[model samples]
Target chain A: MTDAYSSSRLVAGVRTGQQRSIARMISRIELGAPGVDLELAELYGSAGRAHVVGVTGAPGSGKSSLVSALAASLRRDGKLVGILAVDPSSPFSGGALLGDRIRMSDHSGDGGVYIRSMATRGALGGLARATTDAITVLDAAGMELVLVETVGVGQAEVDIVRTAHTTLVVSIPGTGDEIQTIKAGVLEIADIHVVNKADRDGANRIIRDLTGMLRLGPPTPPGEWRAPVLGTVATEGRGIDALAAALHEHYAFLAAGDGLEQRERAMASARVSAIAQNLVAERLTDSGLGDRAAQILDEVYHRTLDPFSAATALVRVTT
Target chain B: MTDAYSSSRLVAGVRTGQQRSIARMISRIELGAPGVDLELAELYGSAGRAHVVGVTGAPGSGKSSLVSALAASLRRDGKLVGILAVDPSSPFSGGALLGDRIRMSDHSGDGGVYIRSMATRGALGGLARATTDAITVLDAAGMELVLVETVGVGQAEVDIVRTAHTTLVVSIPGTGDEIQTIKAGVLEIADIHVVNKADRDGANRIIRDLTGMLRLGPPTPPGEWRAPVLGTVATEGRGIDALAAALHEHYAFLAAGDGLEQRERAMASARVSAIAQNLVAERLTDSGLGDRAAQILDEVYHRTLDPFSAATALVRVTT
Candidate 1:
């Protein structure tokens, strides 16, 4: 854990192309502290280069397997790839959780592909705060593409997934209930839909249902820019080449950009958000205002004042 | 829409229990500009009386219907309730969408029950920034109890929901196939488990499954309380009375002596987080470094400099 404190140095070394330093640096960033904002800002320069693809769906949907296959295919094409497998944190005791990465141990030795696991520390919905920072680290490390595989932890929006250059929403067969159960937030974010584990009995039906549902929502496009539906039996490494092709085509399409302003806007937004988070953390921890705020809240709880006043009081004490 | 703003003002007027100026004063406070923060701070005295209950679940798990039923039940008990239903925002156009509030129209005439529908404006997982402030307004308005309902917009950490004194997670039957879909963050925050629409065939089985799973998780007792599980057919209004009783009991149980300390600690923590957020936001917006950031990021993209040095330049520019 001490490694996390000096992680900025590791991140720096990694950005300069030190392999071991990059590997260690990523773990530090993934630890998710208030301090990572600075490191992330540092990495911002090298980011926005990689064709980032986010893969997410229900847990145990064989997402990691799909990611593994996809990364292998990308590597075969002589492209350096980075893979992020976000695992669920133990709600009971928050710690290093990697139940999703058990399958990826087989492919660990593949030099061209680097895989890392992330924990959320009981955060609701999507990947932990540090995953993006780690991705930025990987992006700076010169990976041609990055694949972020996450178990959909009951999230509706999956915004983190959507922030990537392209997003793949992978669902398996026999999700008849979830098809109706999940909200529109995740669906709207999808650029490419993958029905993984296609070897199952209801694979064809799931694909059909997904296709029908997708059409009901929005018009995909005029000619070829529409979100495509793909099928893959990921565990057996089937249909991976097609998935890889779809990823490349999406990248090329994005490369032929309509507007760079929107992309720049998104990047600037992330930068601003990161800055805000860092400032707040610093104030709360380093400043004695935290104690005074607690005292005011305690007084309010006793019916002497209110929280709105208490919040205002915090501003005064700090100033 | 104007009514809500006026209603918000009316709330602020009543918060200080100054019923004479309540209507006109509330109108001033409801404008939702930066100035309202000051008025809310002034009314902060009456806010602590309310025990906030946050109700959340996967989308289409009938959260809106359940909240409606719960509010109706509370109204029958002669309790003045404030309801905030948070729904997903449209990706194309951002607006404070009210699409999910149709079920809540029944209480339109009931001045005691204020129902506000909020839209998630794609702020880091589709939540609007003003949500917490709006909730605080409801609290200060002299409403005895506030219910916050969300559509699982994926914001990590969920510190917003953590502010609620109690959180109920509603699930339905036939959710077994999608059982892995339950989020760890939401599940952990549960103070009470509600199986709404229990009239379905698999109701008892869902109960059993919940019990079975809760056992695996082994109730560790959050903040000296063990979350209870209950069943309800919210549409039929069954089990609501018991749910209400349990909630009141929990509220009373929470307010008795030692419980205040716990609640105080939670609020204190929130204040720190709030203070931190404000500081960061102010710095980022006021720095006037947007152009420089864009320029340096452009340079880094072209490989003129590494991200590490680019970030330092950005910091130097801003600072």
Candidate 2:
């Protein structure tokens, strides 16, 4: 697998939508194995054709179920789909239960669908980088649509929104009102608002509240896209078609003018900066700079050198 | 105020515990104004004396009330305290409700306590940096104790825990379950577990669950500390003394045998790395390198260059 011949074969296999090759490529990327970059470079040209959709909501909001149903709907349209479930690796949340995989098991034999879960294994910005790379692989693998699902927690949600072309913010009724959802910072990143489990009590009230809040919130420019609140009962696959239509509508909106181009540029810029930072950090750690850092830290601890001066010196020496 | 004389005077005033100077200094730091770094340098020597404590919990968990009660108890022991309330600035949360401030109004005129709220204003890593600088200011202001309270959500909570010497994870009965708390990522970072609103049903159950999880989860090295769960009813002020005692005991444990020294060095290393990264990012953005990045991104977008190669080139050019 480390030889040039094997690498080229892997890339060729991935470009032809071979499941085994695609899985192998993704696994190598996730493990940060050597020589994967060459493979990515070979397959990178085949990407940029898939529409990436991000689905995020608080825990227990049925995000996985909703994403499963959404994938099924996309498949029904004779489209190839890829699903990436981002887990935060929370021990108590049962994020490791493989619930999303189980729910989508029906698509296992379809050959038109692919599913994978990515976890944040204590790497700074590593998950985001792996996710972006995985999306590229899936896109190159001939998937027309890719759904990225994540729990609405911390910086992960923000990163997902930045990476995806369209983002859906999911919520449920009786989840501590509109205020709690807003405080989670997911509302601001939402391109489309979804009230899942719409059959439950207070569903109408939540929709009304969300609508009113959006109205009073930041003013949308004329001719700009306005996020619409939609209701869904994902368990029974209700509203899946409407949701799919809304996604397409959003995509059309992006393609209308310079929106898609500008968005792609912005995303690229973000990715570049993130990778630059990670690379610098990695270089510093891989070299003997840790000892120098410790020495400076000791000086700072002993009040012999201030943190600002120490940091400036460290940056100067390392960069 | 940007001149050296005024900067020295400001530093002196803060060192002498002047409220006006402390407020002004913190405001300047939060704004990231010029000359604040010099002020920080001048005051950095006096900052290591204060015992910094972090209090974090989910929304509607009575975290503010618990912090208020804890502050009163600390003041009763003849210690000057500074309180920093971190608001995530969710427009719907009504962060300006003065809810936490109102609860601590009893100490408003005490002159021994100072409370201020910090809000995230769309800055990358800005909130954490500002919060850390604010703690330095408060520490130099002769505060014997400083309480940093933030909502336990996302990366912000992780940042708070990393910056503080002792961290208290707050929870409430009937809010959810032990798994939910663990999912928040605060469980692993906690130095102390606080179940506020303990009079509610299921408080004991939560304690039992936490205890069981800790027992089965990880093995603590001999002489190292293990987190202990404590119950409290903040409104009634029950268990306040015990909580305070636990905090002191934790402080003693850290102070014994180079523990505090090791922690301080680790913190300094973390801060230096963060500052170095921020400086590199700022330099790249200010150097007209964004256009170069966009050019590379355009190549990547058109499949002329792969993201890995483009990112490597960008990092090379920028750094």
Q: Which candidate ranks first by DockQ, i.e. highest?
A: 2
Question: What are the candidates' individual DockQ scores?
Answer: 0.17, 0.35
Worst 10 residues of 1 chain B by lDDT: B310-319
Specify the CAPRI tier of model 1: incorrect
Interface RMSD of each candidate, angstroms, one decimal:
7.4, 5.0
Model 2 misses residue A188 by how many Å?
3.6
A201-253 in candidate 2: lDDT tens per residue? 99999999889989997799999999999999998999988999999999999
lDDT string for model 1 (B96-191, tens) is 444454765677777777776655442443233345555566676667788888765234324556668887877888855225325444576778
Model 2 pairs in collision: A154-B154
* Deviation (Å) of B204 in candidate 1: 7.0
Give every collision pair in model 1: A280-B276, A306-B44, B9-B26, B9-B27, B10-B26
